[model samples]
Target: MAKKVSDIGGGRSQAVHRALKRAILDQALPPGSKLPEDSIGERLGVSRTLVREALVRLSQEGLVELRPNKGAVVSHPSLEEGRNLYLTRIALERLVVETLSGSLTQEQIDTLSTHIAAEEAARTEHAASIRLAGEFHTLLAQMTGNASLIRYVNELVARSSLILALYGRPHSSECAVSEHRELLDKLIAGKTDEAVALMTHHLDSITTRALLPRKDSLADALHAYAVAEGLA
Candidate 1:
């Protein structure tokens, strides 16, 4: 048995929330998996109240569904929903590149470069690579400094991860890394049109891999994540 998570005395809810979110995003907690409050709390050594708080946050983020009598479960987005998400993401990311085109300071450019380097380093790690790929876009959104855009992009990127888990096939993180580098170059050159086009194409390629649609354990699954989060 995985040992119970400890060391989270007062911040247990946040820790639970992050661990659950990562599990869902990593597909360790697959779509439709039951998130029994007791099991999660017991596994993580948190209380039901903390578990509920985490679930409520995940629910609000569109990563978890709260069924009145059915408790909470990982969200299972339909094909149509997945398609819409990608379309919206494409549009939003276009805006991101467009907004960021000539505006990046040297320090910001270095930050992006460093992140892509990290992505390169994590190429062998499937879950980490995928999460980093999604986060790259959210990082861009944050740089845009548009509060509303940041919120929307963060939500969409997270849901997109869930969508990929449902419908995506085996992927190559190298390709995404290369594309990110090229996109970064375009942004550095202040080529608004070219940058937007590259951003659009990059996102479109990712969507194409998944938008087709096809296709869990609970405690045993959350155990690893609990340990990772130091909850176990």
Candidate 2:
């Protein structure tokens, strides 16, 4: 059994959680990698109790898997799960665009434009580009001003990010950028039907890209992560 340390307390626990979550999202902890509480606790300078708490939070978010006797590992969504996740995301995003059409304030449009600029600036940086791509959808949901819908979209966006990390191949950022611009233009023009249709097509493109096979060995991924994190 992994030994649990109780001395570190709660404030540091949240930090542990954030660090672990960042690692997972950045694919520093790739799918199916074991998350030993002791190792993580030591790495982050937190207690095992803190690491376990962080793991629990991640599990609830569907980013970590908790096994009965084997401890925790990163969640690995199957091909079918990835398809279904994108399908659900498409439905929710369609709702987002439909609600925002003809109702977006000038300030909101400016904010979205700023976000797009940031995405463009990060286009050469793979992880940053992916994170910003997902944030674009979450920002749209936030504009709806519905807490419940925002929460749901946030979770789905995070899951979709993980799916892309696992299954997506390396490619130029131009396609996603162009698709987002088209969708934004439709929304700004108050073409609700066109915006909705474009949103559907954009999400379908993401799903199609995710379904393409990629050759990534576990050892290579882990080594890259270690070097990137200065753990090597």
Candidate 3:
């Protein structure tokens, strides 16, 4: 029988790691935010030791930086690092799509369509769109059926989304809805080469456009940037 994740100390470590990682990935703790170890430890109900270890794991993932005296700070990937992260994500996801092409079944396609539908609904409902778009990629990995690849893709997608949080443009929340559904349709229809090409194009669009300015709120914490861009 498989072990329940909540039954052991190791599981507690993983839970802390996951909780902290998600907070960082979602930018709930935004870039450059100092990780207050004691606060997190209190929240997670773990020792400072566990929280510190979790921070170290996050640092290894490039999501947090361990400063000599400043402790761990959520990473703010520079523009160059942002682009490189996106490029690497493109490469990895391209490979995943290529591998899944001509192999996915009708049921798999249907499942993905359902996930995409939820994403669209989330967009329509005005929920956090960037979070929804990231979920879309995560759903794709889940549907792809290769555990190892899914693990790597999850890491890449998470960190790539972090980069986007740092430097992505206004429409970053606006994922290509029609294109996503169409890619699944194409794959199910046995258009492997076309699916790969379309995957490449989709990633390119995200990477290229995120290089531009955003439609940030005038009242956003980044109001200075919004004003500088004449968006206010």
What digit string (tens of lDDT, one per residue) describes model 1 on residues 107-194? 9999999999999998887777888888889999999999999999999989888877677656645588999999999999999999
Please report, as a residue range, the 10-residue window in candidate 3 with the lowest summed lDDT: 1-10
Candidate 2, which segments miss by more than 4 Å at Cα? 1-15, 213-232
Judge candidate 1 at residue 2 and give its lDDT.
41
Model 2 lDDT, full chain set: 0.82
Error of 2 at 123 (Å): 2.3
TM-score, cand. 2 vs. native:
0.78
Q: Which stretches of candidate 1 lie over 4 Å from their true place?
A: 1-12, 213-232
Tens-place lDDT per residue, model 3, 92-167, is: 7877777777788777777788877876776543224555666777777777778977877776676777877767
Which model scores highest in TM-score?
1
Which candidate should be chosen as best, given lDDT against the real structure? Answer: 1
Residue 143, model 2, lDDT = 97
Candidate 2 local lDDT, 90-121, one digit each (tens): 88888899999988899999988888988888
Q: Which ten residues in a row have the lowest lDDT in candidate 1?
A: 208-217
TM-score for each predicted model, relative to the true structure: 0.81, 0.78, 0.77
Q: In model 2, what are the clashing residue pairs, if there are any? A: none
Clashing pairs in 3: 170-214
